[model samples]
Target: MNYFELDTPALLIDKEIMMDNLHSMQNYANQYNVQLRPHTKTHKMPKLARLQEELGSAGITVAKVGEAEVMANNGLKNIFIANEIVGKSKVERIRKLAETIDISFGIDNTYQVNQIEEVFEGAEKRAQVLVEIEVGEQRSGIIEENDFRTLLEAVKACKNVEFIGVFSHDGHSYKAQNIDECKELYLESVNRTLHFAKLAEEMGLKPKVVSIGSTPPFMLNFEIPNGVTEIRPGTYIFMDSSQANVIGTYDRCAATVLTTIISKPTKERVITDVGAKGITAQTRSIGHTATKGLGRIKEFDDVHIHGVFDEHAIIYNESFSNQVTIGDKVRIIPNHICPVCNLYEKAYLISEGEVVEEIAVDCRAKLQ
Candidate 1:
């Protein structure tokens, strides 16, 4: 069936463009000599996750234990919960999952280390963990070298927790003023992570994997430091308007929401059937030059979605009045692709404007 036959406000993925984005990211990882573990939280589809692994991803990265469980249940063997996993419930879940596959997670504090040790004690296997280092993102991580060393020491003391190495997000790279600044931030993050990894080795801990990446930094072609062993880049698989604007191109974005015009309230105003529920309410930061609206209409050049209601999108372009009419279908490039994927149950794989496949968002609402 054709894509138009599907209901409005449906998620549509351009198969060709998505394949290019995936291969391009894999090639970038190869150039840096780091294993690519594309984060699955972005797409949340097992098919895409497996495709990424088939295209040379060493493994898959997830933000939540529940997401890791979903992937594991779907036959993904190697999984890394990149975010810090705390709480007895989550720890126990991870311990149980370890029975079937290799499970690992991130830790930045001694509290987490102690908790993991207590939960996984006497299990047949130990949980591999990566120490999260805050290079510049200033997010959740061990920023100070002393604190990092302390966390490493705590992990070493844990009989059931195995130290894998260090990892970082470098999320601040998104705020880079230019491509050069993005490159600088990426390099700084890699260097700082490497410093901590070397520090771990000095303390008699073998830091095997040094991972780092974010969409902006990963797109800049920065050299991954010699000690960095893996890269976790999620958004590169389905570039959004925000990523494209930052990187100065839109050729890589493969996912979009297909909406149809349902209202023409005025000569200069139009409304599409998609709104916050369909495209997400996320907007690009003010620093981005292309920041204008919630999304852009792919079919109408220069047409932007001015605002979004619960179930309606407002488009206020006078030119749109001349080109678009009621019932006309338009593709919307979402402001942020990650949450948009979570908001949908499935995505229609479109090739040449036809629905080629309907892929389930198997990991959707797996919020644990």
Candidate 2:
């Protein structure tokens, strides 16, 4: 089947480009001697996760337990929940999953450790976890050395949980003003992560894995620190307009929303059957290469998505107006791929303009 025959606002992935992006990262990891554990949150499809594994990924990282369950049920055994899982119900779910597959999660606070310990008391295998150090994301991670020590000590006290290692996400690097700034942030984040790992060893906790994540910094530095064991960059698999700004190109972006032009309201106005609900309104505001509007038109370089209603993307450019007409189909590279993937139930894997496969987003809406 041809991609043109698919429904409007369909999610399309160029299989060749997708494979290239996957292998490029995998090869980079090998060159750096670090394990590549690409986060599945960007695609949220088991098929892509399997492809990553085939390309030498050590494992897959997910943002939620439901995603892990989806991958695990589909035979992807090695999984890591990159975010911290709290509450008895979630902890109980993790415990059950650990019994069947190699499962681990992130932790930043002591209370969460208590809940995990309480949940896996009678399980045959203890829960494996990584301490999330705040390496400039200013998000959910231990920022203070004292707090890190306290959390590590709590993990030792819990018989049901094991302190495996440390991890950090240099998300702030996305806001870097230039390549030099990006490199500085990358080194700082990695150094901080290594420092915590050293502290873990000094405190008598054998740090088995030291992981760092974030596509902007990972791609900018082009090298993972020597002591870092794993790299988890999700957006690298499906490059987006925002990521394109950071890395300086959209040549590696494999995902695009195939939309049909439904209206030509005026000489300077055109409308397509994709909007915030499809490509999303995410835009890039940082870096010299940031997108001008909501998303970039794959065929028309100067045309941009000026606005998006629930189901219609508004285009306002004389070149786009002159070139495109009603019923004509166009491909739009979204500003952000992660949330856009979540907007679709399935993605059409395309090769040479033909539909090669239909991949069900098994983890779609699995937010529990």
Candidate 3:
């Protein structure tokens, strides 16, 4: 079916561009001699996860147990929960999944280690875990080297837990003022991660897997220090306006939200069917090229979505109003693609500006 025939505010993915993005990331990982474990939280589609693994990714990384379960049910045997897996229910679920697949998760505290130990006790398999070190994001990760060492000791005591290695998400790279700053942050994070890995090895806990994740930093040709095993980058698969701005190119972005002009409230105001609920209100906040709206009109480069109600996106450019009329369909490049994908139930795979097929966003809202 043609994309124009679909309902308003539909999610559209350019198939050729998407494949190029995927292959480009895989090639980058290959050149660096690092395993590319593309995080599936961006697309949340098991079909795409399978495609990634087939394209030479070592495994897939997910944010939640529900997403992991979805991919596992669809035959993805190697999965990693990039985020720290807490709660007894979720720990039990991960332990069960470890029985069939090589499942690993992040641990930043002794409480989580104890919970995992309790869940996997007497089990035939142990849950492989990576100690998360906080490099700069100030998010959930072990900050002090001594704290990490203590956590590792406790993990070694757990019979059902296997120490995999160390991991860190250099998410602060998104806030970089320039490419040089991004590179600096990436290198700093990697250095800290390597330091922790060395400490673990010195304590007789040799880590086989040293992972680092962040799309912005990974895109740069930052040197991957020796012993860094895997790199998890999710947004590289289908970049949006934000990532494009970071890399200074929109040519590689493969995702867009297809919307239609529904109303011309005023000469300077045009409303589309998509709004915060569909395209999201996320905006870029770094440097002089910060995006001004929820999304940018792809066909009209100067037009920007100034505001969004629950059901409509308001475009305030008079030039756009003169160019577009009611019922005219337009494609918008969302500021962020990950959340946009989660907001939609399905996405159209477009090739050569034509809709080739529609794929379900099967893992949408699987936040449990």
| Candidate 3 collision pairs | none
- Between candidates 2 and 3, which one is better according to lDDT? 2
lDDT of 3 by residue, 1-368 (tens): 77888888899999998999889889989988999999999999888999999999999999999999989999999998988988999988887898889899999999998998898888898889999999999899999888988999898888888898999999888888888888888899999999999999999998899999989876666778888899999998888888888878888888899899999988999999998899888898775236768888888876889989888999998988998889999999898889899998888899887888878888999998
Cα lDDT of model 2 by residue, 1-368, tens digit: 99999989899999998888887888888989999999999999999899899889999999999999999999999999999998899999999999999999999999999999889999999999999999897799999999999999999888899999999998888887888888888899999999999999999996889999989866665667678999999998889888887777788889999999998888989999998999878876776336788888988776789999999999998777898778899999888899899989999999999999999988887887
* Best candidate, lDDT: 2
Ranking by lDDT: 2, 3, 1
Provide the overall lDDT of each model, using Cα atoms, as 2-decimal numbers: 0.87, 0.89, 0.89
Better candidate by lDDT, 1 or 2: 2
CA RMSD (A), model 1: 1.2
Better of 1 and 3 by lDDT: 3
Q: List ranges where model 3 is wrong by over 4 Å.
A: none
The regions of model 2 sitting more than 4 angstroms off are none
Whole-model lDDT, model 2: 0.89
lDDT of 2 at 101: 96
